[model samples]
Target: MFGLFKRRPKTPGVARLEPLGVDVTVPVNQSVLQAALEAGVDFPHSCKVGTCMACRSRLVEGKVKAIRDFSYVLSAEELKAGYILACQAKLAPGDRIVLEVDIDSQRPHFPQLTCDGRITAQTALTHDIVELRVAVDQPLQYAAGQYATLRPAHIERAREYSFAAAPTPGGDNELRFFIRKTPGGQFTGWLFEQSRVGETLELTGPGGDFWLRAAEAPLVFVAGGSGLAPVLSVLEDAARAGVARDAVFLFGARTQQDLYQVDAIEAIAGRWAAQFRFVPVLSHEPADSDWTGARGLVTDYLAAPHVPDLAASHAYLCGPPPMIDAALAVLAAAGVADGHVHYDKFLDASNLAG
Candidate 1:
């Protein structure tokens, strides 16, 4: 009776976000990122799984209980500077937390909304990729290059997919995505197993910071597999805005059969305000085949003389971890500054299986 009557420990606290001058309540058992999101705060984030480091914030003042070791993703200097992954840090019970987070002014800030959507169509894009068109219950507003989390009616965990096209000025109730079936991906496996048209899904998003920045630097875009989704969105948006900047798109595929949307890209190039080059690099194309384009890994072309000044370009990359890693190495070797490089790594079930 005494134990039951005793005062319970207070776990809920307030987190003060600097630069933004906002305070959000960190609920008991919720991480700082979770709290911020619940409060409708557009704190930067991607792969809320302690990866990506997009939600990295400096602990200005407070005690935090880390759910996992931050040393794996955060550098020693960053750790020394009190930097922490907000998704992995929970406010200590009854402690006031003060955090410093850099908010980009150019990044679009839209209220994240949740809505139900029905799969209206699914078209095969390649042997392992499909294009899904969903009609959401309410208009979903998102910027080009942003991704959304989707969960089917019965799926336990949601998967992230980038918007395959640019958004309309008002909003678009119809959303599109290009999904590549990962060998053991839960959502993807279920999606490709059968015709899922008319099936309902819950979506939460407009997440990630992969959108195009306002810059005059020449553009270098790299994509592979379904990673082409965001790249296409960004390009479409740029074309619509009449952005007059030289750009080159490097798309990687295993063979001719893997290529899709070549015609659409050509159409975009026609509308582009400046010179635009689309290079599709085939890695496993047959030697005897009629394919005459570049051969070998896509990164090989990063050094080709035909490529523009990579050292003075803004490079946007989206793809599997290996491809992004390879592209990063190539760009670094070509003298592309780290700040000029933007990327979004597509992670599948195998990546988080550990």
Candidate 2:
């Protein structure tokens, strides 16, 4: 019955290479990046889950299937321009392909890391949010907005989550993460079911380059749902370092109930109130409630007067794809340079590794 959907026989591995200015043979089912890595070719990549378009390369020739649905990552124009993600594309047998290497100095370095940590504390931040604090056997250093993968003991799956804790005064021993419960998510489901204090969970080191850069530039941070985790860490780190750069944080949610860590953020802002602004935007609220804050989509609030002059500011956006896309358009229209806008879209494991 399922034979109708059977895939066609795959072509044999690469037979030759000429357009790429190098000779290399890529195996069937191996991605461009994987093949390049094996051949000692240096390329840029982040997230490796097709979420970050950092590894985007122009396909001068050949056809490839994306490992994941990348419609959300690239626009119609970009797709038309032959921009394919190397991490998500496998080389077609005997297909000649051209790779355009990014020469930008800002490209992130992808490192392989392995570490061990135990869940020291697991507390419910909200009904759907859980805060997990882990203490590793040995300290590990990571940038403020970087992320790590947590693999629960005996579980074959791992989940990616951003940090919510700033570097301790002079050490890297403690790490914190704010995890949101996704319906039917494997790790999230396990996190909600068996996660407890003192249970050891294996972890990988810093895997993201989404940290605070350009300390002197004015900063605008917009976060939705669990996206606040990394933003919180950056803000806290800045505050601890006595950074006086002007910064604003816009946290958006569906309702007051969806907001978390308000008091903590407010406290952090208080430390540098002269240079920090924290605003909570709600999409829906009780009509009878006495709420006077910005009410609309987070992008709408960003378009308001409170949003700073993006020309001289760096913007960090973290949220679902729709929210991030909307915010990117708004920021661009407000004069923010494309290079100054950074974002991370949460990709479901099923949607990525599947």
Candidate 3:
């Protein structure tokens, strides 16, 4: 009878973050990143999935059970150095853990804000892409290229989308996003199938570390599908700041119809103090179409006789995992340093499941 009353083994259920000196509870089945966000740790992260390595941190002390394989995104050196993605880490039968995080000090940390937002407008940009403009009840402040997590009342899980433009100074009450509809996506399916313009949404955010860095080097922007959101935001912020660095934007799409925001991009280029070029590469455009622009994959045009020298440029890339991988290979071969390349990989439920 006493055996039935024996106590269960205890887990520390605690994660001690270094540098910031914050301690947060890690509940069973909850990731370390989620716990930190709940405790207001201001951890840098995007795409809560394991794809974007933004939530990576050093596991200084303690073992963690990873939900996914880290070999895909993290390098062998990083793995050897004990770096782990907080979004995929869970307490693994251990005591308290000590983690070293690199929180960006360049910009002031904006506390995670939660507010009710109403969909003010919905404009279809492509066959599967939609631009959603939301007006929130309170002011929200965030750096350009950051993303927000939005959930409609009917959806069980919220999805993250990058801000499609720079925010108004002194915190703006309106937010905008470009969302691509995933065929089986719960949120995107609902958004595309119904008129959600007047519907209220639960919004939380201003998350992510995919912002523009201060540099004098020329900029190389590569984007695919709806991944152009943050790229556009960064360029807008640069234009507003009067930073006249030469830039070349290589945008990729399947067909001519997949291209969007052309006039808007041209407007940005119009005010560019230095040289600016926008190249749209269509991978599968019809052979009979009068498309005189660049054809084939965007990676094919990265070499000379195609685009200018990229050896001294800073590159920003965003897209599906495959596209990002291909672009990274091309960029590396073109002499672009590893540190100069920043990227965000968009992942859906299928990726999370994997």
TM-scores, one per candidate: 0.92, 0.78, 0.92
The candidate, 2 or 3, that scores higher on lDDT is 3
Off by over 4 Å in 1: 1-10, 65-77, 352-354
- State in Å the error of residue 325, model 3: 1.4
Q: After superposition, how far is residue 318 of candidate 2 from its true place, in Å?
A: 0.7
lDDT of 3 by residue, 1-354 (tens): 355677866564789999989888887668999989998889878767787678889999988888898878889999999999999988854457999997767744776798999999999999989999999999999888888889998877888888999877878798999998886777888888976899999999888878888889988889998889999998898888888888998999999999999998999999887999889999999999999999999878776655577888898888777888898899888889877888988775445311
- The TM-score of predicted model 3 comes to 0.92
Model 1 lDDT per residue over 27-138, tens place: 7699999999989999998768786677899999987889888998788999999999999999766779899997778989987998998999999999999999999988
> Which pairs of residues have clashing backbones in candidate 2?
none
Candidate that beats the other on lDDT, 1 or 2, i.e. the better one: 1
Q: Would you give me the overall lDDT of model 2?
A: 0.76
Best candidate (score: lDDT): 1
CA deviation > 4 Å runs, candidate 3: 1-12, 349-354
RMSD, each candidate, Å? 2.6, 5.5, 2.6
Clashing residue pairs for model 3? none
In order, candidate lDDTs are 0.89, 0.76, 0.86
